[model samples]
Target: MKLARLAGPTPVRDKILAIFPGALGDFICFLPTLDKLTRDGEIDLFTRTEYGDLLPASVRMRSLECYEISRLFVSGVEEEEKLKRFFAPYSRVYSWMGSGQPDFVRNLTLLSNGKLKVFPFRPSVSRIHITDYFLSCLGAGSSDEITPHIPIRADALAWSGRLWQQSDLERKSVLVFSPGSGAREKNWPPDFYATVAEWWEKKSAGKNLAVLGPVEEERDKISGRGDRVLALRGLELGRVAAVISRCDLYLGNDSGVTHLAAAIGAKTVALFGPTDSVQWAPRGKRVTVITRNVECSPCLSPVMKSCLHHKCLTALSPDYVIGRLEELLG
Candidate 1:
């Protein structure tokens, strides 16, 4: 359905709804694109309702709810009928997944009674970062067309900064280390992280260093050295984004936090394990990945039978990563 087009930002009703499914970091990357849309129409969101309240007030201008549009089909075919009746009012329907599921997009098109128009941006890994890739879903055009912006809450930044100041860092090149990843096999040894931290200590003398993660996940990465490195556990994800944005550099395993760091414009050094660099590495000019260039690795199929060793990460010594860090910091 061609639907109606808003050619030059002409007159239209105010309310418009955007369908997005992801965390705050994912949504932050879509800010530039969303901001453009909001200039012409009021942007509502369909996401985990918790995000409705969690988003900063600056972003709160957009209404949000746990509208389970993505779950329309899986629930049952009959549920699709309800979606059609429910969404018939909106003039624009956008799927943040962008060509995610043909059926899903078709459903939105159907629900809008052929009155809603669709726009999506899909890009390859080398051509654009995931953030840009996401912006593309909003029909974003060029790199400059989608500017990088993070709506950080002042209160959250102040709270996180106070927590950061409590550390022993007397003004050092702060590095937010995340020795964690989505897959269990992707984590480098905590000892290796400590080794890199210690090595960087001499290089970044007078700089602060701390690791961010859930306390339950990585409490031991900073066990003995209370003064050198601080482990910030139990931070809200939005606050974590705030902390990462303020940091000079981010070093970590392949994880959402790595994405968060790069999205925030921090210089990042990401370590690859099972995930492919071409597909999953942070999309930034300043970002670099340190891996041993192992063979038969990056097998990211979610299931593992038995492997000889996790040499992909173990083969990369702290010295090698630190050397690259020196070059990057230079």
Candidate 2:
């Protein structure tokens, strides 16, 4: 109940609704705060349905369609009265989607009108990790030791075991590589990943590359080829997380998959480019972030609109990543 001290003036109530939409890593970053919130009472989640299995069974997960009601409220399509009535049951609604949809915060606050408390999280433009920002939104102080919370179910672990067994790769020390990200600009070139895979295959006999992500669904983009390199494209999110959980190391871009890998306790070597590594890198005990010190780097913009050449990622040579990979593996 102590962690229920959210930003609004209203008293803590029996139930709370947390509106968290897309971007898997963002949701993972908010998990620690969500875990703390659950101590107060049952928390209803509004996130992408794909992540429902990753969360604890105690919490109730809702579909993405359920969150469209807020879009209507923000767009003025739904009347303020209807919005108020729809959310009246919950004692308070805490939203972290304000950064993407500023109007959602304004409309929700207006509709609440002191009847229901509303905490629309909007952190200042500071150089802090995203997880820190998530905690700060709930009035919690930042801590270096604070890590993302991801609970791997027993079944997920079983699934991972089956994968290794099926491939006759049970004894091999696995290295998961997620070569793709939502933003193409942030990704280190696929050739860089292939170089690492090649080096890993030669250097270590009992090693495997568990290539992950939907990006591989487009086969032409990546040029990695080796019997040891297993492409695991289009697997369910939970299954992907499960497989990464068993791996000894994870090499990836600043992507959601990297966040999941780190959250589940894999040693992570994340290559960050346009996105600020200081503010967005994965947070974990064994996480190492590699980035080029380009002057115009970390544009902090969601899209690479202005810069046609992504020197930040391109400059991060494969040798540099391989060196880091060696340091972690050793």
Candidate 3:
């Protein structure tokens, strides 16, 4: 019995830290990796503090200041001794602080002096879904299905319920629409969105909720004229996610909020223009990506081309979108 009791060294549970100072979409893509890591052991996330309320229950959301400190450490503005303290707490650290920052990763590894396991994450495959790429960086391997997971808090749900009640949309099949993107060209013409809103309201006999972000407020183009379509603005990301989760369907451009809608399990129709849908489209079983495939379309980058007229977007008629909407709603 004693001979059988010969023991190996006690195993240590992995304490993981992930630094991703990125936007909402980027962080959403990385969520599967975070979910996987949490199954193994404890994990902490260093992302935008503004999104702290929306992080997964499995991971601890650390302050954005931690990432800024990491940047300082990489830049050599802070000494190794101070930076070592930051690295010492975690058994492994995954830094995905934007792509093309190899030097920063190397600096972080050096500062840790081989005592900490530090890894830098970047996307290599342009064709694959970004979730797959993010998972690869964490050595989590690739998933055939790339779905985003967003957590909606109780306060947000309550807020959304209140908003719906106030707008007299509580009893209707609520359809949420977002007409904003980082770039103007990625947006389907405002008239197209308005037309879709009007048609959707008529078909589903549902109330349309137009949720616009700060970028949209300035343009002031996408709007619903009647009481049947309510225009909501200045909502927090978490609140928007909660509202989308309650909605029957989501219609939006290729934007972060579109990704958010898909993550929260809303059936989504994502309009695409010059941007690459293969790489950036919202991933979900119920998601439909509509694009007019032109020879020069899908510039594969967000940087708007000099093609003054965005035919890729403008050419997509309201009738075509309505046909897709029928399929989704049916």
Candidate 4:
């Protein structure tokens, strides 16, 4: 993705804090709200430190994994003075974390002098997209369409360019595949992805690259096919986005990387299985979602966990996915 140019940083006036302890996809959904809040005041985002590269330069990042922040979850007025000192700088706080915990909410509200607003991490119902649900919580109209975008840093792009050169694919059209998702049930079969890759390579004469995150690495499901595709492993989030930005098309399950691919404006085809695609599908101008309309699909997480047969995903053949990709490309 190209880096988005912004007018100089917003002037620091009132300090505003946003606490998000969600995964990458959830955080992407919250970006529009973060952008909106920045217009009101300087924003401090408390999230995983690794996501720092994805934030706008004006927004400050604090590590949510630190012990000091974890203190908020403990029940007590014991750390009152310390917590007060920490939150005193913020004029207002919007937290998607700890909404269900009365103690956390009470403490944060008391410490921030009632300036802390808490919202559920996810909507109670799946009637609306997560992005719209987040915006609605911030008093924005649900009808407003907010697409999350990540500006690629120059260094990451340069690194990706070098990778392409080294792989002897600098002039080739490339299709990137990510076959693993956070949930095992969400993933389509690895062999199915290989089949699609073969079809893509044959039809478009394109190079194939597979992004293997820690989850995929642990499972050892999609590696060992070096002859068919190049693998990207052990890269930071920023570099991963950079690699994805240069792809002609990206294919993945309902995973964070899939959301990243869409956010960075990569043409993406998302494969959905046990999840609700309407609520969780990646949002972008050039994104397509492929799913089988199994009667038992879109089941609750508990039901998905217990399901022995992932008919929802298994029923979606590689040929069907390839057909969708062809339509999307056209």
Q: Which of the numbered candidates is closest to the native, going by highest lDDT?
A: 4
Question: For candidate 2, lDDT tens digit of each residue in 1-330?
Answer: 467655868665567777776588888888888887788777888788898868988789887576444464456633556666866677667766664555665566655554333444545766877787777767889887999867787887898898889987777767788888887677788777777777877886656555555565324444347575777767777788888888877889898988988888888888988888888888899788988878887785644656778888888898877777777677
- Which runs of model 2 end up more than 4 angstroms from their true locations? 1-13, 67-86, 98-122, 216-218, 221-226
Per-prediction TM-score: 0.73, 0.85, 0.87, 0.93
- Per-candidate Cα RMSD to the true structure, in Å, reads 7.0, 6.1, 3.9, 5.7
- Residue range 119-177, candidate 4, lDDT tens digits: 99889877689899888888987643479999999999999999988888887889998
Stretches of candidate 1 above 4 Å error? 1-10, 23-36, 49-71, 74-86, 96-110, 115-147, 168-170, 206-211, 214-217, 303-307
Model 1: lDDT to the true structure: 0.63
The alpha-carbon deviation from the true structure for residue 265 of candidate 3, after best TM-score superposition, in angstroms, is 0.7
Per-residue accuracy of model 1 over 1-330 as CA lDDT, tens digit each: 889966797666566777666654455556566677677576666665545424434332333333445444342343465666667666776665535556656665666666554444434444355556665655666563344444566777787677667764436567778776555677777777787767766675734355555543455655455666766665666677777777778888877777667666778788986656754566666678777767867674643324557878778887777788788777
Each model's backbone clash number: 6, 0, 0, 0
Q: Rank the candidates by TM-score, best first.
A: 4, 3, 2, 1
User: Per-residue alpha-carbon lDDT of model 3 for 74-157, expressed as tens digits?
Assistant: 566335566667667776766766335655656666655543344445455567778887777656666557587776799999
Error of 3 at 120 (Å): 6.8
TM-score of 2: 0.85
Better of 2 and 3 by lDDT: 3
* Per-model lDDT: 0.63, 0.75, 0.75, 0.86
* Higher-TM-score candidate of 2 and 4: 4
